[model samples]
Target: MIYLLSDLDFSLPLSNPVVVFSLVLFIILFAPILFNKIKVPHIIGLILAGMIVGPYGLNLLLRDSSIVLFGTVGLLYIMFTAGLEIDLEEFRKNRITSLVFGLFTFLLPIGLGSVAVYYVLNFSWPTAILVASMFATHTLLAYPIASKYGINRIRSVTLTIGGTIITDILALLVLAAVIGTTRGDIDATFWVQLAISTLVFGAIIFFVFPLIARWFFKKFEDAVSQYIFVLAMVFLGAFLAELAGLEHIIGAFLAGLALNRFIPHSSALMNRIEFVGNAFFIPFFLISVGMLIDFSVLFKGLGALKVAAVMTVLGVLTKYLAALLTQKTFRLSPLERGMIYGLSTARVGATLAIVLVGYNIIIGETPTGEPIRLLNEDVLNGTIIMILITCTISSFVVERTAQQLALQEENVPRDEGDSNERILISLAYPDTVTELIDFGMMLKPRHSNVPVYALNIISDESDNGKTKTIAKKMMDKAVHHAAATEQTILPLTRFDVNVSNGIIYTLKEQNITDLIIGLHRSANQHNFLGATADSILRHTSETIFIYKSVQPFNTLKRLVVVVTIKAELEPGFAHWFSKLTTIAKEAGLPIDFFATPETIKELQDQQAAQKAEVKISCHAFSNWDDFLIFSREVKKDDLLVIVSSRKDHVSYQPSLEKLPYYLSNYFGSNSFIMLYPQQVERGIKMDDVQFVDGSLAETISDSVAQVSKAGRLWKRLFRKV
Candidate 1:
């Protein structure tokens, strides 16, 4: 049993699981690193590695059951991620364009390919149609490259994903019908049954699954449990799709769509999903694709070579034609056309599924008593080779196109001041840490390099040993939670005489632009602003957000922003506006702004200038006399954002003093934010002041005082409105 390596048999194909696993892991680790030096896309490297080590090459590994299982999961994960990351709003806007592209991609290939397959390959009608259908179908194998480049939100990418689902459905339908015809099951009743089952399956995936996922997420807070629940839902959808006569990928995609709204693109859950799939499952799938290639068939005869060449040419050409037609019809850019073609050209998942189904159907036998299958060995081998070629072209083209697009978009202008914006979250209550971190993340700008800070301040009088241990645990949890979302949270703990002083000190030291703290849970009518929040607000000049949530941010239905008249004049107006709109866009929620006519006009102008994709509806509301009237406009599930102000600020009102008391009494069950925007610092540095124009400076100061006085007068004059 203690045999040495020299004494063991050196097999051509490795059978030991440990050896096979080590070889695959090594391939996964080094293939990308090795290929990066040569400037080749790592996706190509993985596939090539698989081919070199597969049974057809050096025979170091076989495509065993374990490989097949992992590969299948990887394929489904790719489809799921495609759906999960798609912009739902964009998808809706381009549904018609997607349909046009889908029809072109599907019909062009099948129509031309059938003729080529029949005459060039000399296949019969049934077999020819099946083979041609393979040309119409393609997998999203190159999507990971596009995702890595961070261009998934672009219009061209959204259109490709939309078209992908459309064409795949049509392609799978064709496979079902062709198989039915071959099996003598293509009767009227069979079509009716298929239609009914497909509808039922769609309803279950799109309608029922979301409800389940929503409830499950709200009830369970454990990260591991939530991840496992999501995976279970994905496979359940896949299994049900199979029972309904559709491919598992279709179900996996639909499952993603159903849960899309629940998972924010930048949340911890989305990061985990993408991380696992990209790091492990997706690589496994890519390797298995290369293992399907068989070069020996090409050397055995010319028939297989001819078939492979024809299939590859038709597949690539037809897909290009489809992309070109879509470009012309939609007036898309040349770069976008190239992107579509690259994404739609790869043929692997559905192609293999259809070919295997055809190859397994036996119709007759030769005089030698050999069974004559629907798809011969030559076609099977040709399909495998075609997979290799198309995948290579797809990976290379997508990589180049994605790089170009990312560069082009980077040159476009974005918000200016946000490049330096950093957010700090003060963690006190154990239950509010996750929501606080999530809120901070949503408020931060996308693709920002600034790190989020989570702080826990321990009282100096408390026993250092026990208190420090507790604070350390809390900080560690905060860091781990943020890391799941691919974000780095700097965890800090300090001993201070006052809790608010600790937060204020950290804010100044870190140059934090925004401070987010949870509203006190035990505050009564007399103790409303909570000692800590009040103290921090009175001491700091940065933007401060006091939040309390009765439900998860993702589960909220809408964001209702109550803008005070002149609130837009605050120093931090643009910063807070940008944050709210970003949250709306990421959560895929519409926003309703209740403000005075002047404020509404200003908001509309800002929204148009930013060209934000959020659905915004502005309503005229200047009812300062009774702030409670606005409470009727808010639903229990809505996120209410009351734009309050400090007493020294221009937007401050007498009615705002009573806002906390009113909210606790009337809207106690709803999630709300008391947002206080940054005000101008009061102290002016004497060194920076100049006496170049004494009269001019004095006149400007007098004019500012007059404006402040006039603003108060206007508020009084229109108090009843």
Candidate 2:
């Protein structure tokens, strides 16, 4: 081992595959940490490290097959992840804006680029067109920065992402045309073939792949198998795209879209995919891009420098012009326009692909009968330099603009109405405490001052002290989880003979305006809200939310709210609506409101009157039975919310009791919440008596006698079982 260690020297060119792999891994692991300390973008650091070890610099590493393999994987991973992370609902809403930006960004750059290349560089028409197409393609290099700052859901960001898809596809198509024309294959048949093949490719990826994935996911329960299946789909999409005469990135992106609804962002499968890509594949691709840059060429003469400067200036200027036009047309703010420009300026994947394709094409012959290259070595090197410059500028600009946008949003007051709302989550199981806390945070108004309470109730059994200690540990875990999001949770522990009584005591003591409790399953396969959640729902006038999450809250793509008839008449309707809207905004999902015609009209009137921030689409449903049809459409990544009422209330119906049963049978794997809105007071009459079984009967019987003696005593005083 010592002899082998002595023989291994990384300073020199390392041919052993194992040694090369180790050295690259070391660079990947440490570059980000070292660069982060100095406040430099980790991506830039990875690129710089790649340049250092590349054949052009220290000659310690060469661009071998391994680099090519990993680099390609990284490129696909980047596109796939982009599709996976995009807000589809937002994308659909901003499709027109995306199309406008796409056309402007593509046309402006190509027109400007071709004219400049042809007139200034004196290149031929074919060569000029090919070179111009390079400027029309860009990579979302600064997307991570926007995402990190939590501004990814902003309209500008979504528009930019949507435009990226359009422009990249268009640019790559132009590349194909240019390549075919140069290769002397530009005939009617060529166009027809390309068109037909692209359609076929889209059908397979968008329609067929989803069908297969749905069946596979339904049948397969193993986590590892699901992950491998997703990976397979990505590769299959890429391969199919190549067959259709399009770039593989297009296929990978389509694959991501195909699988988006099936795999929730908060699922373990998605976490695994992102982890592998960010940890290894993406960094490798960035490094590979950096390895293409030959600094020596820039120092050689003014010609290369001139080309690099011209390309970089033209790229940035054209993107800026496009963004300016878009901003004016859409009446967007200056900061939003800047963000659009910054996100759309960086040239990488498609740019490199176009340049390389152009470089390989032979358009003419020199005087000596040698093939004349469409892209010369100087042009290639200059393009690489432009890539480095644009990427750096794009990252810096995006970071600054995103931060500004975030700060501006923070300062702007949201019109959620004034209310000191507090949500208390009753913890029964330690495993679900963190998830429950996250759900509460999602429902809470952004930047609000209201505190979140996490309560753990210990039963007054023989092992009370030991249970309290365990409860404290669980509460601490929940507190730690909340702290990560910069949220403070008030932890409360109580001992009572009945768990439900303890929860009710804390709810009253803390004056909680809202209650969140977990939903479990009973032996009969029905959703068991437990005696605790049931008692609170029946007795408390405060709004109550019962949540059962099968996956992470962030994974939700849509918030489906089922509003019963006359739901609008409830006193706490506005409060629960505000909470629902807050969850939608925080989760970056649109709200699909299913309600009766009357209720829908009322809701629309109220929304128009109050200028709410949430995007809602209303669907009419006659009654609760419509939920079965709706459930069929609810994907795995959706959050199902049912707004209910207490017994004998105007909106209360017998059918509401069957909702939990339906949800359990159909959507057991999906996350759902049931809310019971607060009601107005009606004088209680001793003559109007209703029988309820279990703990509710005992508590209510005690409450009736106490109520006769003392007018409306607190419900907790009757809990002496």
Candidate 3:
């Protein structure tokens, strides 16, 4: 016991690294749980715990280099997550709203806060401006709350995230100009250098980074390696931003934007990103924030108290006024206005960086030889207290507002049709399981409760023991991969006379609505449709997808869909269209639909009715005889979706008979999906399905109604005779 206590001298700001880590881990684990029980947010708990454990409180732990490093990463993670999760379509639609809010948030805070600072604090022009600019900048500390509540895709959140980058950029610019003037480095050369470097940084992040990232993802399939690569890119952006005379947070955010298209929100990579950040780094940063406060300073003098009070009031007021003005300008709801205010009110990250820079710059000395800094100690302490208050307020407001928004959204009913969708994926090859599951997920609705069915059908003639073992292994791999993305899949293994019979029987038994099967490698030379695929297509009418992937879905540049004329008349047209749009949205890829003018009009009408937010480029091309005419336009990386039909379907054309040959000969190297929509006769009927306990009451009712109708027809015939 003495040996164990030997390392514990009860020293202030504990020096033992192992002890420090253990204490922090424990705090992280329990602080949030305890705080949540009392109706307080976990964010506040971590922060308040930091205050207790930090040098300013009980001095149980020091805010050392490791703490600062992790804290910085946490800040960057917050910004990065914000950029990654933004609904790009919403952002694009309200780009002007974001810009307007950005301008208002920045100008109001600086314009109003500067005057107040200059007069109330008796600060000079430069010092006042530098201090005021800090108010203009806000960290996205409360963004995680919005993300947690699944409101990140909402328009108000998108606008806040977009406006965050804008305000941070403007605030950093003011900091540079003020610092440059104070250093007597304000010149044309300075302005030119800043502009040129910023442009270069933007180019690298937007252009060069994505190219490299796409290549990296295509080259490597390991989830861990992919996650590491993302982190490296994030830091690279941060380093480049520093080189460009900007804050690292801006670079981190830009990196997220650049990589957003490649990393789907529902992908495993995204799950890992959010999990790691929220679990450890973000909490550490929140705690470090709490450690920054030294409340004792507020008691030493009335001047410090005055400055703290003024800064706190002005900071909160200015951000509120900006949000209020934006709300009025856009005619947004009160909840939306509160959301914006909560997100933007927190003064951290860039704000802290700016204040520290101000405090470090020495201008002159007093008669007593005390140094007169750009920002004095009183202001710094005041800023720290202000950070605590605003962060607390921000977290509480965002938590409450996000909860309300989530509840409100839940109250709004979703389409009941989507809730009943049951997707089935037939997995045979080990190489395609991950891609198949991911593709299936892309086609699934977010609000759907049905788990995807992954079926592995074994031939009855095969060695049952050996084949079952191999199938189980494959199913395990599928289940594990699906689990990584926070999705659950029900694995089914069935044995029948043949693979096709097994798949067909399972589909019928499971009442599957959609079937996704990987294109078998056995289809060589003459057989474009392998035996199993041909059999399933001929026997079943559910939406079937023969997916032959040559590249990862995330790496695909665009979705090139070849729609047959009158294809919209099929029973599965709406279902297949929804799936295509879902994939496009999930992968952040634009869609190019090649169809006749009439078909294009139908597609346009469907898109409008669904309100699907994806870029759809329509090209009128009715030359079915010349299928290769548009081959040159489709890039090597594009995923071609050929919307085909059954033999006697309304959209089936003679030219479609040679489609497999055309695809094999011309676009052989390209990744493609041969989609066969459900035919009219094979459409799912309520009376034909089996429910719980194999009940068939609906089917019995249908049979009785049909017999009654035949009896009425017989009576009418007798009367006529």
Best lDDT goes to which candidate? 3
Ranking by TM-score: 3, 1, 2
| Top-scoring candidate (TM-score) | 3
Kindly indicate the candidate among 2 and 3 with the higher lDDT. 3
- Candidate 2 C-alpha lDDT tens digits along 70-103: 9989989988887777766677778899999999
Off by over 4 Å in 3: 1-10, 683-721
List, residue by residue over 397-437, the lDDT tens digit for candidate 1: 99999999999988878667767788899988777888998
Worst 10 residues of 2 by lDDT: 706-715
Could you give the candidate ranking by lDDT, starting with the highest?
A: 3, 1, 2
Predictions in order: lDDT: 0.85, 0.80, 0.87
* Candidate with better lDDT, 1 vs 3: 3
The worst-scoring run of ten residues by lDDT in candidate 3 lies at 700-709
Model 3: per-residue Cα lDDT over 1-721, one tens digit each: 9898875766777887887999999999999999999988899899999999999999998999999999999999998888888777778899999999999999998999899999998989988888889888898899999999989889888898888889989999999899889989899999999999999999999999989988998899998899999999999999999999999999999999999989998899999999999999899999999899899998899888998998889899999999999999999999999999999999889989998988999988999999988889998999999999999999999999999999998898776767767899999888789889999988886655766999998898788898888899889998998899999999998878999999999888988888999988866547888888888887898899889988888888899999986676565777798889988888989999999887788789889978889999999988788898757877888999999987755567788887877887788788999999875445433245422334533332233323322234334333533
- The TM-score, computed over Cα atoms with residue i paired to residue i, of candidate 2 is 0.81
Deviation from truth (RMSD, Å), model 3 = 6.6
TM-score pick, better of 1 and 3: 3
